[model samples]
Target: MTTTSGFLLDQVMVTRGETRLLDTITAHLPGGHCTAVVGPSGAGKSTLLRLLNRLDDPSSGRILLDGIPITELDVLDLRRRVGLVAQQPVLLTDRVAEDLRVGRSELGDHGIRELLQRVGLPVEFVQRRTSELSGGEAQRVCLARALAVEPEVLLLDEPTSALDGVSSGVIVEAARDHVAAGGTVVLVSHDLAVVRGIADTVLVLDHGHLIAHGHPDEIDYLEAGR
Candidate 1:
């Protein structure tokens, strides 16, 4: 994983017709740290996460990655460096090892097994059929796949939203380990427990507006009914 001064969003806004999904969201998410984005449903959380990896370009504004505007970089190269694990895990291949090697072809069985362990999967899972694993296991494999390239940043969109506590814990541990090892993580989560547990900084959004940016305790999830 590569670490550098991270994302800078300048007056970013996203709109579709008359509706704004994000209203001038500006903030600097430091490298090698975990930043959690929290908001109620319909508050533009997913839309915000998509822009980080150019899954969707911002309607208007500048997003800089490692001091260069992301728009100026090749889309594929940028995505390679900024890997994303969406809420749902969609295994690209039928086999686990093949799915993990999608980004780096030279990744061997040993490397694939190591990645699986890192995400809390048994090494034996290296040869398991994707369709045979449970939801939690598939999600972990998806996370390992993202980590396989050793990306500069991990853009996780509600990764643990649908998992059980045990599964969620594994994912949270993986994110923390990534940051501890100097990789950046940007997470969008509605589960307040997740935000408080792993977030070094929290960004609160409401109705397309950035309402708060500070430590996790700064945002009162109770009062906001998050």
Candidate 2:
């Protein structure tokens, strides 16, 4: 693993033309904690999360993992340690089992089944076609795929949006379980209730700037809006 410590952004900024997508963001997401980034659309929550795993680079400043600049690490190795589950789940192969083996080509059926079980999927799901899965089922499959690599950190964007209670609950528990097992999770969401349940620290953003960050109970999320 490239890092055991969580992410740190130092005076980071992202600019396009005259606009700043993220401005001077500075935060420490410690290992073994769930940190939620929340705000209305265009708040730069996703922008900031994307920077952690090198999906996008900052115009200025740095991002570090385990006290080393992310730019200094091999991008592929970094991604393996810090897995990302995007807003939409995309299966690489038609079958669910093959999709989980993207970063882990040598993973056997036993390992694949364990990953599915970790995400609350049935063993039978291994042979199912991704196209036949429901929204919730697909998301679970994505989660299992991300977990297949045994990532130290998970970056989730809008993880539980528009899902049934059972699926949402499973996703929530997965984040919690990851933290419980000494891993870190950085989650971006519009749902305050979900954030309240999982976030050990909450970051409120507005128009590319970090407005507030602290424990869930300390932040005034009402003013921030979804």
Candidate 3:
């Protein structure tokens, strides 16, 4: 493993088309801590996470990971360390197992089985078709796929948004366990209940600008909603 880690956003700006999404913002996401970004629709919460992982280039300023500027690193290498999971989970392979092994060439059935169990998938899922999985099952598989590489920073864009209570709980539990085992998790969620239980630190953003930065309980979310 290379000595590559840590993320710092210094006066960063984000834009899509002519719309200025995120204004110049500076923030530090400590390594190995789970930071829940809470905000309503149109807030730049997701955009912030996207900028950190270099999924989208910033309009201005700089993003540094482990003291190295993001622009200077190889695109593929940068994404490998900063894993991103979207709201609508996408499985890239025909089979569930193939999805997990996409970035990890060294992973085998045994390794896949272990990850499956960790994410609450049955062993039967290894040989099952990706299309056959349920909504929650697919999300778990996506989480498993992300964890297979053991990324330093995990970007989850409401990974549980589409699942039922049982599935949501499973995914959340797995994520908590992953961070407990020493992975940095950055999540964006409008669900205050979910953020309250999991977020060690919470940052609230509004209209592409960070409005409140603190624990969810400390700040009245109702006040932030206005």
- lDDT against the true structure, per candidate, is 0.88, 0.88, 0.82
Residue clash pairs of candidate 3: 6-66
lDDT of 3 by residue, 1-226 (tens): 1334457778888877888898887777766777888777888888888887777888999988887898999989888988988777899999988999999978999999999988878888999999998877887888899899988878888887877777677777877886888888888887666677777777777788877776656767634454
Q: Candidate 3 regions off by >4 Å? A: 1-5, 222-226
**Model 2 C-alpha lDDT per residue in residues 94-196, reported as the tens digit of each score:** 9998999988899999999888887778999889998899877887888888898999999999989857778788899989999999999999998788899
User: Could you give the C-alpha RMSD of every candidate to the true structure, in order shown?
Assistant: 2.3, 2.4, 2.9
What order do you get sorting by lDDT, best first?
Answer: 1, 2, 3
Q: Model 1 TM-score?
A: 0.94
Residue pairs with colliding backbones in model 1 are none
In model 2, what are the clashing residue pairs, if there are any?
Answer: none
| Per-prediction TM-score to the true structure, in the order listed | 0.94, 0.94, 0.91
RMSD of 1: 2.3
Model 1 per-residue lDDT tens digits across residues 1-226? 2333789889999999999999999988888899988888889988988898899999889999888899999999988889999888899999999999999999999999889888888999988999998887888889999999989899998988778998789889999999988889999988888888999988888999998888877777624555
